[model samples]
Target: MNHALKTYQTWLNDSAVDEETKNELRGIADQPNEIEERFYKDLEFGTGGLRGVIGAGTNRMNRYSVARTTQGLADYLKKDGQDPAPSVVIAYDSRNQSPEFALEAALVCAGNGIKAYVFESLRPTPELSFFVRRLQASAGVVITASHNPPEYNGYKVYDGTGCQLVPELAEKVTARIREISSFGQVHKLEQTEAEQKKLLVWLGSNRDQEYIRAVASVSPRSEQMKSLAPQLKIIYTPLHGSGNRPVRDALDALGFTQVSVVSEQEHPDPGFSTVASPNPEEKDAFAMAIRMAEKEGADLIIGTDPDCDRMGAVVRGPDGKFEVLTGNQSGALMIHYLLSSLKETGALPDNGAVVKTIVTSEMGAAIADRYGVQTLNTLTGFKYIGELMTRFERDGSFRFLFGYEESYGYLAGNYARDKDAVLASALICEAAAYYKGQGKSLYDVLQELYRDYGYFKEALISRTFKGKDGVDKIHSIMEDWRSRPPHDVDGTRVVRALDYLEGIEGLRRENVMKFVLEDGSWFCLRPSGTEPKIKIYLAVRKTSNKEADQALKQISEAILTRID
Candidate 1:
């Protein structure tokens, strides 16, 4: 009759509970710490949807948690009424249990009399956004963890306008999720029953074609590509995720004849057999692609993440060695090539603008400004950039020419509200070809950019903290830093601080804090929303590459000391 055992008994007796779930719950009933961690609180729904480890606990991501979230969403939609229920689109990536989770969500929506369009198989996250807008669906859900590890999965919600729910709307969804007392109270219909009731609709190749056509139209250099396409030797890898077919189709349509796909990674693999992590932002993820590039003697190498929202590239340097470009360098090259080509062809818009996150390197801003284009900085997520694009399209302020984040996400057109690595793969190869025609390498352009913009180097350091205790430790670390802010770093005086959680400019109240030193070095600290880690970002501007590297090392050691 103890509290924990009683809760378990209630779950076992509930008609909605399955034998498998009951068995799993039985194993944790006697573990006090596990029970406390699982049932102490509910998973939070923030600006992004729910993301956590996949397990049988309430705090973890599971069918029950997904059902409750969908029911909450259904309730919210019911309140914002029309004669018929609102429509929703669901998509999944190649992750363990992703398809099951997507189907579970679709069933819940169908049970609530909502029209649900579920993809036949795994697809990229950005395509879900595009499908929502193209189908004019009221909302969308993508089951993915972006670049998180295999054990983790996530659910992201998007509005009718194809952007992630903003803060105010997310708060409402959170409130509704909180109102649900237990997972057994959430209702669901069998797939067959839902389909027979005309509530579930399966989408296949027709939608894929529509998305591909939209991606093709975003090409600003199609005509130039026709002339140089055959000569471009490019390599592409999806990293065993979802980008394989779409990226290949986009390139072949642009008349690129010599494009090669990394054979070992072309098929979707939930285990991501070829790399340690499927994230394109990490150099280790490109090991397979690099080997393939060397074998093919390719001029450039490109890889997309598991969800295909981010992209990374490697190019042959002037010294005949291949080097992976940082996110900032890749983004700068894309903007430089896209704008320069359009301006040359008299296609550049008079009010062109580029959007980037505040933590992203300023090299992009410098490049855009050189071309008479404005660069706007937003908060850390692509949703903010998408929101900005929607606003610009609503009011005639400026045309959204391009938008990117330093984590390898980039977008050139408004067809997709999220970053489309499939589109990026096509454009990146075209840019490489355009530069190759001028007898220059992408590396050459990057060096020139650094020479002109000063040697600006940036690095990201992430520290992982897991389990319930880790959360408290992370909080304590941040609180201690707030109490005794670093006045100096690496023998340099801190000149200014920007805290974003406070929403202030100089002394903002945000969870994020940025410190600028006397030598123009800067560092920032923030907790990651989608993962169990704290990230520190450092940037230093110096006159030479060696000096910048030295400054970066010093600053990194200083930050580590403070953390320790």
Candidate 2:
């Protein structure tokens, strides 16, 4: 018998397995392909943690997988020796089984004699990171798939510093998880017993209030917000996720009175029925918000993802139509606003620095350079940006003014180590108000930045690869690109090639390749860490929008042709 088949059979026969789960297994037993897909391998607990389709299989995210992963994390924590009473904070977003999975993780921790602080209800991922440091917990776990589809759910871990576990620490946890063979063998305590033992603690509005107060500190011009917020019309949608209360509360606290929520997406819906996907990056996610904004004559529309860590926005342009701002454009707007605001208020630090991923546009860096603030680059993950923040705290060298990615992730204050949409939402609105006070829209300010700096445009191409074959193809593509990088792209000679896998330019080893063209444009290709996708990032700087658009299209076409 095949190993997977045998494993499936064993699962069917195990008394410890719930009948419902076994019934699911029985339903798929006749389908060998389904059986193979489910039992071929254990669901991996990757660097940060597990993210998979919620289902009843070794390769899926279920209660058993959640418990097992948490048990392994518990064991690792014990070995790592955090404190006498090691503790972990847990938060869940609005997704099917998010609450159940969170409780299961907490039970596993309690079973290991570790204290677990769990939110009474769903909260944003950034709050989980913030409270991890605020409560002095050993670690934190957020149950969410972020902006992924409804069928998907995830478990992400954060260190005491409130950043996702770096490579070294993640390796330790992954190794510990591998040593555990059976998900069925993972021990967990009953919820009642855990509560009675005082190992389980519930976090509530107190934490939420503190988190909102911290978000208020990100406001650029509070006085201006007090005046302009009432007049500035804004529309926001959480997309049936966790951002409803926090995002709204943060804005209201900052005196933004004209804010309106999309009623259809105001409450948590596990299915996210209103949108095709809950990702804010997608235009569909903003449909309801845009319509609401149009009806209300709002100046801006903002949407947050499932976990509420990444934020996306749309602004009414000069053309009298709403246009969505790419993450790079919004990032540049925030950077320019932050530095310029600080300078105007005489609060700009001498040792201030802005951090961004290598794939992010250079426009923000250019804006920072003009302000005499230093700009630093990191690998593509917010974890890397958070890691740099930790270093900054320890060395007291550079004050982290802002950190962002080409994706919709942004961070302004150090209150939370991760990308914070709640804070970003407030800062973005304040920036809008400041610009509004000047008789302009956020879009206008962005245009001014483009004119002041060069016209910088960026685009991304993500190709999905499913199953084992897809994984191999992604690896092959990355390897081929790394080994033989393009010498010229779209008639522009390649100036330099940086293969991150070779650990060049002081960056840690990663499977990413970058080609810089003589025209000062660059493109990078790398495999996504959490998803089964290969992403290509392209950016170009030109004197005009037409030239930039042309250069970007040509370079992107050339790269796609090579891939095909």
Candidate 3:
């Protein structure tokens, strides 16, 4: 029998597997393709943990997989021998089966004699990071797919530092997960029994209130906000996720009385019924908020992803139409606002530092330079940024002013060692209010920044590959790019190229290639760590927006041609 076929038969015969799971397997027995897809391999417990379509299979995110992954983590925690008793904080976003998965993880932890502190309901990913440190837990886990399609869900693990597990730690966890022979070996505790034993603790409003207070402290100019906020009409949509309460709570606590929530998307809906995707970066995700903004004549429209860790904004442009600001544009705006505001009030510290991913726009560094603030670049993930913050905290070398990634994730305070949408929401709205006080719009301020610091624009193209064959194709493309890099982009000479796989510029090794063009334009190609997508990041600097945009278009075409 085929390997997948044998695995399928075993599942059907295994008494430990649930009746519903066996029935689902039985229904797909005749379908060879379904069996192959589901049993080809276990849904990988990647560095971040498991993420896959939710269903009954080894290749999916079922209860068994969740329990198995938790058991692996528990074993690792015990072996590492954390001080005193080992405990973990657990949180979930408002995705289908998110709450259930969180509970399953908690019960599994309890079975291993590890205390589990779980949120009573859905919360943002960043707060999970905050609670990890606040509660002084040994580790943390959050159940969320983070703006992926409705069918997908994920589990992310964080260290006691409140940051995602770094490469070394993740590798150890992965090795432990592989040691678990079967789902049947993973133990679980009944919820009631766990609670009775005090192995399960529920986090409630006290945690929420503390988190909101921390978010409020991220604002650079609260005094100015107090005066201008009431006049600033803002439209915010949670996109059917966890942002509805905390995002609003932060704003309201900061005295932003004119904020309006998009009614259709204000509540948690697992299907994300109103939008095509829950991602804030997509324009379609802002449709309802845009309509609400137009009707209410709101000055700004902001949307957060399902996990509330990424934020996207729509501002009225010079053409009197609401335009979606790319992640680069929004990050640049926030950086400029935060730095300039602090400088004006003499609150800017000399040791302040700004951090961004290698793929993020150079405009942020330029803005930071104007303020004499240091800039640091990390590899692709926000965890790298968080790691830097922790280092700065330990040695008292540099104070982290802000950290951001081009994928709509931003963080301003050390309160949470992760990208925080609640904090970002507070700062963005406050920045809008500050600009409004000066009789200007956020878009207007962005244009001013462009004019002062040469028009810097960025574009990202993500090409997704599916299945085993597609994975092979993605690796082939990366290998080809690394082996033979292009000499130019749109006829501009390539001045330099960096292969991160070889550990260039004091950065860690990874499978990424970056090329810098003679005219100050550049592009980088890297495969997504969590998903099977190859992302191409293009950036250009010119004296005018039109020229910069045109340069990006030309360069994008040239690169895509070569890839194809």
Candidate 4:
């Protein structure tokens, strides 16, 4: 037998292998190609946790991998021991086998003699974070693949504070996961058996109530809601994910009387039957919501991803056509509305600050500066922003007012450590109401922002490379760019460069490289950590929107010529 097949067979025959697990292994062994794919290597556990296509291999997301990850987490929690019986909260999104995966994690936690609180139904990822703190659990796990396609699913680990596992803690968990040599060694207990031992518990509306109360407290215009709430018409779509219940409750609680949910995409469909992808950031995903909005003559439309950690909006433009706003544009509008409302009502704090990822538009910084609030830039991930929030709350530094990323993620009020699309949905509706009071549309607000911010525009280009050959191609692209960087793109001369992998700011050793041009046009090239893709981000600032777009297109072609 080949070494890889032998290793897998050994796992199948091991005494620790459960009947169901053995069945899965036998199925994989029946197909040679399946064995190659599943046992090629272990599923990577990085800062984000385990994410991959769901299948029967060791490389796929199954009960064994979930159990192994939970065991590692249990080991870490025990090592950082505060209590003999630490507790954890588990939540799942609307995905195929999500409930099964969530239960698998719960069972593993129970087998370790740790208390586990499993949600009664699919819930938003942010709510899992909120539940962690609300229950004061030692840790939390959310089963989701966020905006990925239907074939994919993932596991995201959250600490006691409800934030995704940070770098240091992730390393610890990775070490433990690596130590578990085979899937057969991982332990688990049946759900009923664990419940009888008092280790497994079911949680429900109590945590939901706490989250809703916290979200309600962050409203800047509760009194205005009473008067203007009846006049506004808003359309919302959960995109067949988990935000259906919480988003409606938040809108109703804020006194919005005429809110409608997109019926075609309302239910939890793992296939995301209504759209090609469940991501709110894409215009295609909003097609159903847009049709509903036009039918109902809605003023604004909002959509959340399957996991509800990211949100997007479409508003009526001056031409009477609905236009979907980009992530940066929506984030900037939210910041403007929130800060302006707070300042108008004497609620804006002197210590207020905002956080955004480095690649996010500088338009937000321009708005923050005008308000005399500090804006801090962090790494690409939202967890960095969450870490900054932790620091601010720990020390007497600037207060964390809002934090967001370019990938349609936003957070407000610090109720949840991760992005809360439900909060963004509510805030977008309130912002629409605020604009309606002034006889303007949210599109008008975006235009005004562009006028002040010099028509700042950004675009993202992602090239997917699949399998082993794809990895080598991605590395070659990065190396080629590093060796002979672009001195000029289109008609613009390169003014500066920033590399993140080498930890250099202007010119660093990192694998990421950014080229700044004389015309204020820029492009960044970086490899994705979770997937096999190379992403290029282009931004251009011009006096006119057409000029900025032309510049972006020119630079994009140049980048493609160099990389592709």
Candidate 5:
């Protein structure tokens, strides 16, 4: 029998496995394919930690897997030992089984004699990042799959600095995870026992106000907002996740009295019944919000993902139709708004700088250059950005003004190390209200930006591969392109190529490739760390929006034809 088959048989015989799981396994006994899919391998504890379909198997996300991963983390924390008893902070989003998994993780920590500070109910992922340092805990864990579908759930670890564990730190945890032999070896404690021992502590609404206050403090145009907010109509949607309360309270605190919530998506529904995917980046996620905006004649619309870390915006364009702004467009608008506002007040720091990923658009950088502010580029992942922010605070080499990526994720103030939709929501609305007071819309300002900086266009494409065979195909695709790279497509010359697998440009080694064209257009290819998908990013600049859009389409098709 295969290894997967043997693992299935062992689960059937093991008394430690739960009765419900055993029954589920028995249902699949007649189907070898289902057995192989469920037991192919332990759900990988990658750099971002574990995420998988919620089910019963070594390769699935269940109570056993959650506890097993938590054991490794507990062992790692206890290895060096602490002068004081070590503690951990835990938070979860409004996903199915999120609350249960969170409690199980807390029990594992309690069983290991570590104190656990768990939120009383669901909260945004960034709040966990904030309280990790606020509570002075040893580490943090948040249960969420972010914007993924309802059937999926995840576990991500954060270091003491309130930043997600980067590659180096994550590898140590992964090594320890592989040492545990079986579910029976992991530890657990009863809730009453944990509470009696004072190992489990519950957090409540007072902390929510502190987080909301911190986010509201990032509003740069609060003075103008107080006077103009009542006149500016805004629409927001949480998409059936955790953003409903805090996002509303942040806006309410900022004096935005004219705000309206999309009633259909304002509450927590674990099924996410209203939207096909809970991601705010997709236009379909804004369907209900748009109707509300149109009826209310709102000036702007904003939505955040289930975890409330990523934000998406929609505004009226020159043609008077509602248009969804791409990540690059929204990011560029924010950069210009922030720097210009600072310049107007003469508070723009001389050593101020912004950080973006390698795949983000250049328009933001171009705007920063005009104001004498510097911009730094990092490899993909907000964790890199967060890690850089921590370094800046430690050394004070440069003032960290902002950090963002082209995935609708942005962070403004240093109060939190992760991308925060609550903070971004406040800033974006303030930007709109600030400009609206000046007798111009956000779309009008975007047009002015295009006139000053050349028109820039960007596009992103993702191809997913599933199951065991899909993994082999992805590896083959990466090796093929690495060995034989493209030089020219339809007479376009490739001026330079940056292969990051060799640790290019003071960055760590990563399996990513970028080809820069002679006309300043470029495209990048990289495999995602959290999901089984490869992403392609493309960008170009031209004299006009039409020309830039055409070139981007042509180049994207030429590249896709070769890969697909």
Candidate 6:
């Protein structure tokens, strides 16, 4: 029998398997293709941990897979020379079956003789990072899909320092996971028994208060926020995920009186009925918020992903129409406002630095350079950025002023090691209020920044490939790009090339390629660590906005047309 068929038979025959899963398998017994697709391979780890379409199979996310992965993580936590009395922090978002999956992981930890700190209710991903560090746990687990569609959910693992495990450590955990050949072998405990043994502890409201205060305190422009509360009308949407309460509480604590939550999307919605996908980076995600903003005469609109780790903003632009700001645009605006605020107060750190990803635009770096702050680039994922932040704390080399990626994720304070929409929301709104007091919209300020600095435009192109052959297809595309590097793009000479697979600076080797044009335009090709897609990133910097847009378009066409 083929390996896929053999695994399917074993799972079906295992007496420990749940009846629901057995029924699912039995229903598909006649469909050999379906069986192969479902059991072809185990779910692989990625930037967001074990993520897949929620279903019953080795390749999908189910209770058995979740429990099995947790058991492996548990073994890794209890390995020799590690913590003897290991405790794990667990939090879940507002996704279907998220609570159940979280409970299963907690039980698995408890069964392995490790304490489990499970949140009493759903919370944001960043808050989980905070509590993990605050409690000094052995590790952490957060159950979230993070802007993926409702059919998906995930499990992300974090180390004691609250940062997601880097590549080396993730490999260690993967090794342990490989030892568990069957889901039936996963360690588990009854919830009541774990609680009675003092192994299962629930985090509560007091911790929420602490996290809200931390997010509230991140804004240095609180005085400005208080002054312009009346002038700045804002609309926010949680996209029916986990950001509703904490984001609102943080705003209230910062003394913003003119904030309003999009009523249709303020509650927990695992299905995310309002939008096609919960990702804030997409323009459609802001449809409801935009309509509401128009009626309320709101000056700005903001939205966060399900787990609240990413944020997106919309403002009335210079054209007098409401336009969504790309992640690069948002990052540039926020950094400019933050550095200026700190400088005016004479609190700017001499050794402060900003961290971003390799695929991110150079606009923020230019703005930071104006204030004498340094910029560091990491691999694409936020975890790489988080790992760098942890290193900065350990060594006194530089103070982490801000960190962000071109995916609408940003961080301002050291309260958490992950991207935080709550903190970002507080600071972005404060920036709006501050500029409003100066009789300027955030868009107005953006135009002024463009005038001072150069105009920068960026775009991302993603091609998806799913199913068993998906991996091979993405690999083929990447290899084609690497072996046959472009000579020129849209009449611009390719002056330099960077193959990240060979290593860049002190960072680990990554599967990415970049070609820099003579006109200061550049494009990068990197595969998504968490999804079955290869991403193309294009950036252009020019003296005029028209030139920047034209160059970005021509470059995108020249490169992307070759993919097919």
- Top-TM-score candidate index: 6
Q: Report the C-alpha lDDT of model 3 over 269-332, residue by residue, as the tens digit.
A: 9999999899999999998888889998999999999999999999998878899999888999
TM per candidate comes to 0.95, 0.98, 0.98, 0.95, 0.98, 0.98
lDDT of 4: 0.85
Model 6, residue 401: distance off in Å is 0.7
Mark the 10 consecutive residues where model 2 has the least summed lDDT.
41-50
User: Could you give candidate 1's per-residue lDDT for residues 1-564 as a string of tens digits?
Assistant: 555455556667777778898898888767887776665556776435788888876678888888989988877777753426599999999988999999999999998889899999999888999999988888899998887888888899988878888776777777777787777667688999999997899999766978888888877778878898888888888988888888888888888889888889889887887788898888888787788788888999999988898899999987787898888888999999889888988989989999998778888888899999999878777888888899999998999989998889899888878888988888888888888899888999888888988888999998989767788878888877777888888789999877677786432134777788898778888877767688888989898999999999999998998797
Candidate 2 Cα misplacement greater than 4 A, ranges: 1-3, 45-48
Clashing pairs in 1: 500-510, 501-509, 501-510, 501-511, 502-509, 502-510
lDDT measured at residue 352 in model 6 versus the true structure, 0 to 100: 91
What do the candidate models score in CA lDDT, each in turn?
Answer: 0.84, 0.89, 0.90, 0.85, 0.88, 0.89
Q: Which stretches of candidate 6 lie over 4 Å from their true place?
A: none
lDDT of 6 by residue, 1-564 (tens): 998899999888887788999999999999999898889998887777778889888988899889888988988988832788899999999999999999999999999999999999999999999998899898999998898889998999998888888888888988898999877778888999999999999998777998988887777777766667667788999999889899888888887778899989999989889889999899999998999888988899999999999999999977667899999999999999999999998989999999999889999999999999999999887888888888889897889989999999999888788999998888888898888888899999999998898899999999999877888999999899889888888788999889999987788898999999998899999888778898999999988999888888899999988986
Question: Model 2: number of clashes?
Answer: 0
Candidate 5 runs further than 4 Å off: 45-48, 80-84
- Lowest summed lDDT window (length 10), candidate 1: 504-513
lDDT at position 97, candidate 1: 95
Tens-place lDDT per residue, model 5, 89-179, is 9999999999999999999999999999999999998889999988989999999888888999999888888888888878777777888
lDDT of 1 at 303: 92
Q: Per-residue lDDT tens digits of candidate 2, residues 508-538?
A: 9988899999989999998887788999999
